[model samples]
Target: MIDGALFVVVLVGALVCAVSAGALYAFSSFVMKGLTALPPAQGIAAMQAINRAAPGPAFMVAFLGGALLSAVIAVFTLVSWPGEGGPLLLVGCALYLFGMLGISAVAHFPRNDALDKVDPEAPASAAYWRDWAREWTRWNHIRTAAALAAATLFVLALVR
Candidate 1:
């Protein structure tokens, strides 16, 4: 029963990580490009709107829910220390929880918060918009990679 529950959790965690990676990939792939191509004010306004809208239910479910699931998987792995799947479970949880969520908290949110403080139409805001888009997208790539990697690890754990 415990094994069955752990398997379900791992499966859900993998799916969540994949969903997160897909969302981040969209930003890194085209969303940032499309937004940045606009005039600075327009781009800034759009990004600010996106940031404002990001904290709602669906995203919170994937983002926070993924973290919560990862934490559970980590605890389970530590407690049981199963032969084959244990290391994968631990690493996958760590990568998703720390690499994806941790980077977002430490690197991305600060920039988003700073962007919120600036006037979208201001000259300084224009310069900052360019810099922000570049830096934010770069960091997002890292997040995308982490989530994708976590998903892969979880799937591997499932197979093993």
Candidate 2:
């Protein structure tokens, strides 16, 4: 039998993973699509507001916290190595830790941070906005796919 506490950890990790997936889904589906409809400057302004607010405590919990929790899941899974859940959890670890969070930390954050430093009203910010938004959304698509996959695997892990 799976340890109750460890099962709880897996379930909670799955839930947190879902939150990350959902956010990426929203961004992939409507958020970026909506942003594309606006003039680049307006889009940049909206994105700036979003980027600014995103690092706040609540989102950070879901964002960075989920990643950290997933790392815990990965480590615990390695140590405990539950029967059917083992491989699934390992796969989830790769997807969540490297695929989702890795891409976010490595690719997305730097881009956002760079954009944050630029003046949105400047003549150059338009091009920067266009490039940044497009690239960010592309990377976001990767995040969405990886997170969704991880979530599915986690669910499987939970049941096993």
Winner by lDDT: 1
Clashing pairs for model 2 are: none
lDDT of each: 0.90, 0.83
Candidate 1 lDDT score relative to the true structure = 0.90
| Cα lDDT of model 1 by residue, 52-95, tens digit | 99999988888888899999989888988765688888888889
Candidate 1 TM-score to native: 0.96
- What's the true lDDT of residue 114 in model 2? 86
Q: Which prediction has the highest TM-score against the true structure?
A: 1
Tens-place lDDT digits, model 2, residues 1-160: 4557778877877888889889889998999889878887788888878999998987778777668878888888888765658888889878988889999999898988887777767888778887788899899999988887887888898876
